[model samples]
Target chain A: MKKKVLTKEDILHLAKLSNLKLSDEEIEKYLKQLEETVEYVKNLDELKTDKVSPTSQTTNLTDVYFADGETNERGLKLKEKYFIVKRIM
Target chain B: MNLHGKSLLELKQLVIEKKISEKELNQYFLKRIRKFNPKLNAFITVLENNQLGIPYGAKDMFCTKGIRTTAASKVLDNFVPPYESTVTKKLQEAGMSVLGKTNMDAWAHGASTETSDYGVSKNPWDNKRYPGGSSGGSAAAISAYLVPAAIGTDTGGSIRHPSAWCGVIGLKPTYGRVSRYGVIAMGSSWDCPGPMTLNVEDNAYLLKQIAGKDKYDATSSSIAVQDYTNEIKKNKKFKIGIAESYFAGIDDQIKKHVYKSIDVLKKLGHAVKPIKLLPPKYSISVYTILQRAEVSSNLGRYDGIRYGNDRNFFGQEAKRRIMLGTYTLSYGYYDAFYKNAQKVRSIIIENFKSVFKDVDLIVGPNTPVTALNIGEFEKYPFYGELMDQLNEPASTAGIPDLSIPVGLDSNNLPIGFQIMGNYFEEANILNLAYQFEKETDFFGVIKKGINNYKD
Candidate 1:
């Protein structure tokens, strides 16, 4: 998968949606700060996990019995992933 | 009646024993506010007409029904919530008096209160220095002994950072330990409201009153509230881990004072060891993205169409964060920013978890620097980044971290001790902090006086 790299214009567009009217002098500050932040976060992008299952919850609840079985947000997890994929794609 | 230097617990005791009346305390404090607030600028609005006639607590971001919860942002300058925040309700019910509203960074965006539109909160220690912030006003008011204690919300160290710099006690309870309802939403996933006091006992008592379940906040955990005051009174010496990189980037004088404070603990017979915790560099990086993302979304409630009454509503910093957050969480940039930050957040949490395995608690400076000149961040806004250096890590990990005044510097400004505990180990954290407080009466020395000023 080719990773999506964010451009300065992307931040500007997002900034607009956020209601921040950036001055011409300020675009570069966000770019540099966000870039430094993004570069640091790139470490997460480098992780290789071919053999290990990713951790979801910190606690071990491999088995549990519930009468009502609250499955509301749990099922939405699948829907959310699908939606996220479609949106990101 | 004038108990300016008393900690919250001491004040409560004094009030309960009838040594002081609430009216007298309130009048003294209201008088102090009138006397010194001109110099300190610690308040956004002091509701002198509230007719409450008492020294009630106030955190700048927490909603107080009818009093205004502007979050020190121009965005909320005129916006007032119709209801009281859960914590405020609890405090009011507990007979805590309302002094008035303090100021903060607009919607709690920046670490220094500089982001606030209402104006800056200066340190009571030296009016020129920062009181530490987004809870800078609460910290300043409390450190100046104006109120002795005030509720402060910690989102990425708003409470603890300022508490540290201001030479007071501030606690960031474990994630979900305190209710988030009524706090003007800043960063929900990371926001946990706590107290800034002049002592460990006061912090614990405040935590006891504030920590509990709330149906209003579904993410709030169903945890049993432990009496932290009693717990601290009967605690053992703890094995504390020294966080490696947290103290690394700090300036030399601060490093010297912190190390000497640790030596005091070492002499007290606790096993202290050097531990390689998560490199703290990721805290601000992860927090910045997540905070901006959340701020953008949560503040959408403040659209001129909804919360704000006028189209000209919203303050400058609130606007900046909303715009920044919205931009980051927007189309084409969501994954590039928010989701990526979340994944990195996972890594940061994992790093801290790995450290907690070996250590019962971690210790470090609350911020890289102690306190700064008021409004310094306004000129060099990037300096705010340096302020939350040690704060964001503990806050992001959602663990309990307490800051206590360690000692003052050559310039007479106070330095603080920060102790991070494993999840739900606030008992141990508070205990260790209490023991450290006992070792040196440094806090008492801090309150030598904020003497009455004549205008």
Candidate 2:
């Protein structure tokens, strides 16, 4: 497998997808480091994993429950609810 | 007399025995922090409110209601959480007083606290060198005797690396063995909250307090939490394995000192033998893919809304990792990179399972070398990741790994004797570490005080 080199455009697209804006210098830094990182990770391709099962997490739990929402003293319903972000106009 | 050299477990006992009030204990640690923190840069925040008990420092990443939880990032610098983390809450419930928040790698991304937006946490031993991190500040606090113990979260050697460098005890409990509830997420599956302390007994006692299931975190283990304190006191002997591969890339002095510690274990009635183990380098690749993927996804929630500043608030290390993660988990590359890494993760876990079948625990060096001087990242961009090479496999496998002082290198930097046990085998590892600690005097040697820090 040919190791993929991450181009500046690739990183720019990644930054966009990741919701991050990068400066020209940051882009240059990522270009070199990310390219090297990708190359290093290419070693995974060497192992034959066609029949292997992926271990995304070791916990093996499913259907995690969250508490029911209730209105706090502030008159807003709360319970696992994150702070509301300002809407982008 | 100053309480700086005492173990937290010992201090807690004194508090219970009425030898000292919790308020007095708090004052002793608070005074030490005030004196040493300017030199060590170990603390991010020092709380004024005091409670009577064993004072424990928390890594800034763990959310504490009304107190700042920065995760050492500029994004969350002003953010004060409305709730406490489950682990810290348990500590509070168990009578451990919160001293303050310690420094860490920004978002716990890098191994060194140098990545923290606040300031680099200095090594307590040698001010010129790094304290080894993401949990560097926690380890440094314990090393400097600012606090007897501190809570640290480890994903890829965050707790263990700094423990090794700072010359203290670092225990990375089995994944899910401790709750992640209210912890600022970095890698969801891999992040584990553990203890860094001056002695093994304190590490065990602290683990006992925090290890249990939590309704808030579904990933937390439902397994029965062991009486780790009592477990450590039990006399036990078993087979110990030392893998040649774990020592391959480390410095000669570290390798030599670790072997000397292994010999101490042998003298204590445990059989030590060389065992064939999987190449840990493979874990570097898997950890790189999964951690980066998770980092990108986890940090996605930071949009200057509910908590921190916008995406623009990330540091270079965080952005670098985020970009790489986004690229790897991107549409076309998902199967080849992200999926393949997970598949390989199973192989790494299987490798540990096979090894654990023969040995009660595996022993090795915690890092490739002792803590390097600052500016290491400039010379080698991957210094943190590469330094963590030996310890990452056990982490990726979700097993418990403990690092204790083996000996010091030629430069006087500490070498760590790493003992990795099977999943849910934290007590086994702690027992061996405790036995080793009882037999050795390395802990006292380190506490003699660094020559450079003027008292």
Candidate 3:
């Protein structure tokens, strides 16, 4: 697996996108630190992952215990409106 | 009369038995807060100032109507919530007093509390050394005897690690064990709020009061929590398992103290067995990756547009996670990094499952290093990176973990042992710690250099 080296420009763009207004002093320091962290994460590319279906969840969790529109006994009864857990599938 | 070093169990006993009133104890902490919090930087907002008139939980991170909820970030520095967290409501109903809110890493990012926009929380033991973070404020306050107990959230050892550095007890309950409805989110999946206290029994007792099902959190488990305090009292003889893998190359001073304590456990009619838990090295990588990935998702709400100061709001550390997480979860890199890490996480969980079959409980040296100086990690954003090495293994598996101060080092800083239990088996872990507390005055260790502490 080829290691993806993050260029200085790439680091700056990411930093900007993340809304990190890096001072002149922080740029050089973060360039190297971010490079190391990026490389640390990029090391995962060495693993074989072709056949696997990407899963974003650790468990196959469902709200079977606590049904929607109908509340269970966990203080949801205290208020008329409650926020539902939005599952991102 | 000496409240600074009293355990929660001891303090609660005094409160319940009328030896001391809860109001009096609350007043004592309120006085200490006024005296020392200025020097310690342990609080950001200190809602209700000294006391909650009635007693509100401190921690500016917790949202309460008319109270500021900064999450320690300057972005949402003035933001206050219209509602209170379930824990706070429960504490209010129980007549528990909240001294004042403690400080932390802005947005719960670092290991030491230095990242807080407010200022660093000084270790109560030695003002020079740091109290661990992002829950450092809570740990420092509890350790300094400002408050008998306080609540902090744990994600990648935030609660437990801080407790160890400050020489107190910290608990990270099973994932989804506590509701995350009101507390600001750090890493959504891993964020869990638990207690930090002066001893194991106090942590256990507070945990019982807070642990329950929450309807707001779909991830919150429906399992019933046992009376953890009572569970600790049963079965004097216990099967305590020690992690040989985690101990392989820990600092000799900490390793020596842990093993010596194991000897004491053996003498107490309990069996300490060497268990083959997975090596802890990859967990740092695995956890940092997963938590960063969740950081991308969880912190997205803080666009400074809707929530916190998105533009100039977060600290350097928060920005680092946002960039790292967004990069990892970006268009092309998901499979190798984020996806593969979860599989590795599964393998780690499987290892925990296999080990639990043989050992009744698991133990290891809690942190790779003890309390460090305030500015130690100023150059590097990841403060105390090595100490985080051992904590993530159990955290990734969603198992309950406890860190208790076992003894002090040559420098007299507290050394802690991390104990883990089967998923949702916090009662057993508390029992083992309670038994150890009975045998040794574990909470008896004093803040050695307090008289000479400096700003």
**TM-scores vs. true structure, each candidate:** 0.87, 0.94, 0.89
Top-down lDDT ranking = 2, 3, 1
lDDT of 1 by residue, B1-455 (tens): 44656666777788789898777777777887887788888888886754442364577688888887777766677768877788888788787866888877777777777767877777777778777778888888877766767888888888888887777788888877887888888887788888887778888888888888765666566668898889998858767788667777687777887888788888988889988766666667667777877777787676666565442456555555565567566677676667766666666667778878877888877777767776567555443765787888877777788888877778777787788888778888988888888878764535643442321
Scored against the true structure, residue A89 in model 1 reaches a CA lDDT of 35
Model 2 interface RMSD, one decimal: 2.0
Off-target runs (Cα >4 Å) in candidate 2 are A1-4, A62-89, B381-383, B449-455
i-RMSD of all predictions? 5.4, 2.0, 3.2
Candidate 2 residue lDDT tens string, B304-353: 98767888788988988888889989999999999999999998888888
Highest TM-score among the candidates is held by which one? 2
lDDT of 3 by residue, A1-89 (tens): 76646666766877766656777676776666667776655444454445544433433466445565774444333433765544569
DockQ of each: 0.15, 0.56, 0.29
Ranking by DockQ: 2, 3, 1
- Lowest lDDT 10-residue stretch of candidate 3 chain B: B446-455
Give the range of the ten consecutive residues with the poorest summed lDDT in model 2 chain B: B446-455
Query: Over all chains combined, what TM-score does candidate 3 have?
Result: 0.89
